[model samples]
Target: MQGSYKDKEGEEFWEEIHEVSTNFTLFLIFLHIVGVTMSSRLHNENLVKSMVTGKKNLNN
Candidate 1:
């Protein structure tokens, strides 16, 4: 690949940035799952199923 940065320091800096961003994104995803699980338990609803089916089960 054609080098975009002028020196090794620049490349290393960007690589670090990429790694940090990727990890942060995964962490955020984990938090999202936790939030969903908590919400499902608190509300006593199958939130994941509803999300997948695009329908909510309502008891009459």
Candidate 2:
């Protein structure tokens, strides 16, 4: 891999790969954060509804 990047073309290809990987990693991280936040919000909402109604709503 080190030797392959000695040429201009290979270097360009490697840079593109790096950029793509970085973007993909950031996207995954963003998805994970969004999932966690949504789950937490749902849990809190359920808790609040349960407290108000004095019963758990599990139908949905």
Candidate 3:
């Protein structure tokens, strides 16, 4: 005489989905960092420093 089994199943499914989404988000963050680092190295620019200081040299 309480919540039905179906409700419990649905809750478990949603929990698993939430876990998967969280893991995917973390993976995306890691991928972005790698991409930024590789790009900085390839371009020979201190991208992270510029981003933190909000200053970039203009060669115009």
> Best candidate per TM-score, number?
3
Off by over 4 Å in 3: 58-60
Residue 17, candidate 1: alpha-carbon lDDT: 100
* Clashing residue pairs in candidate 1 (N, C-alpha, C atoms within 3 angstroms): none
Best by lDDT: 1
Off by over 4 Å in 1: 1-6
> Model 3's lDDT to the true fold?
0.91
Model 1 Cα RMSD, 1 decimal:
3.4
Weakest 10 consecutive residues of candidate 1 by summed lDDT: 1-10
TM-score each candidate.
Answer: 0.85, 0.63, 0.86
Candidate 2: lDDT of 51? 61
Ranked by lDDT, top first: 1, 3, 2
Q: Candidate 2, residues 1-60: lDDT per residue as tens digits?
A: 555546878789899999999999999999987876687587755654666689876765
lDDT of 3 by residue, 8-35 (tens): 9999999999999999999999999999
Clashes of each: 0, 0, 0
